[model samples]
Target chain A: MKVVDIYRAIADSTRRTILDELCEQNDQTLFEICARLTNNHGLGLSRQAVSQHLETLESAGLVKSRKEGRFKFHQIDSTPLDEITARWPADASRSSPDASRTTKRASTETEEQS
Target chain B: MKINWTSIFVTDQQKALDFYTDKLGFVLKHDIDMGGPRWLTVVSSEEPDGVEIVLEPNSHPAVVPFTEALVADGIPMNQFAVDDVEAEYERLSSLGVTFTQEPTTMGPITTAVLDDTVGNLIQLVHQDEGAQG
Candidate 1:
């Protein structure tokens, strides 16, 4: 699977929400996914639209769908995202002393304000 | 907190990748294959670990209208910080980047806008030295 595909899959905000829904509760049917998106997120996308989005996600390896009886269940597969987050080492950004100091100062100020 | 990932929608991922890396001088950070579209990302060469810019495909049904409206209004969807807007603008122009807005100074910032060739207008900006102080 090409890494660009995962980025493409998640590029759409709606698709991201679908992934979030699946992550919250895996093995959701198409109907369940659409209902959850509308009820929870106020997204009233058509079932056909949502299904197409799922196909894109599935093609990118960000989602997996299985058939059980007459229903097709979709599940989130976050391994592709892991590759994205792993691109830059944890300490790469932390190596900047000025940035770290600025963060510390900002957090300290926030703490004092709170 | 630091930003780890940010994305811009592109009509074509391959075209955007070439424009971003060749014209914008960003380095390819990740390019993994899933099945169809690859999970591609790029980072600025100056800040390799700063933030990864994902060239996302605008495949969502609603994306067409949203992007169209933004483009119609000549509004940039994303902005990139540069050391010098004029210099970057000139460099990019030499490399065939079409600028919708020339480098112009406004208060404490200088900005220029360019078409990313993938259905998005990207802004390049530079904060004036000592503007914060």
Candidate 2:
């Protein structure tokens, strides 16, 4: 499967909700996802609409669908989402951008001295 | 008027009869010969005189596509009430039945979807007490 932009995949509110539902329960059928969207989240989306959302998530490697026997089940793969935080990690103590810039400069200077 | 019977389209009548009676424990209520496709129906063993489920043949051109789409999405064509869904899930699983969805609670109801093996999904549901709507 070709991986697409994770940000684009998660941009839609419905797609994010799909991920949320899968997080609560790992493996879910398309029907179960639709039911929860309507009942729990009050989003009455058509099955085709949900299918398209799933396709988008699949392209981003955020979801994986497995064909087991006659039915197909979907499971979330949040590993691809790890790239987002890896690109810009969260720091608890850093209050300003200058502090992070100084830390990066110090690390670069140490690398140069070595 | 009371609903005496509800129908589910099955790929084969004999296979549906076997699954419904032998596997699901529904007692055979009627087996009248209606020409090519027999008027086959079955009732729950617990309620022999209750509503009968008609296992109609999916010979219609439109029925196959309709059922196929539903099955593809893990949608159950019909639902049956059970006292305990998890217990039934165990019982049915032991009987070589294929379940697409396990018992999951949503508010007051717990439901599990399983393949009927006749081109339709059947849901076994258990509702919590005092939560009737």
Q: Which candidate gets the maximum lDDT versus the true structure?
A: 2
How many residue-pair clashes does candidate 1 contain? 18
DockQ each: 0.01, 0.66
| Native contacts, share recovered per candidate | 0.00, 0.71
Q: Could you list the CA RMSD of all candidates, in the order they appear?
A: 24.4, 3.9
Which residue window of length 10 is worst by lDDT in model 1 chain B? B68-77
DockQ of 2: 0.66
**Model 1 alpha-carbon drift over 4 Å, by segment:** A1-114
Candidate with top DockQ is: 2
| Model 2 residue A41 CA deviation in Å | 2.7
lDDT, candidate 2, at B52: 95
| Candidate 1: tens digits of C-alpha lDDT, residues A1-114 | 333488788889999999887877787656557656776788999877987898899888888887543235678999878877566446655677677767866776798799
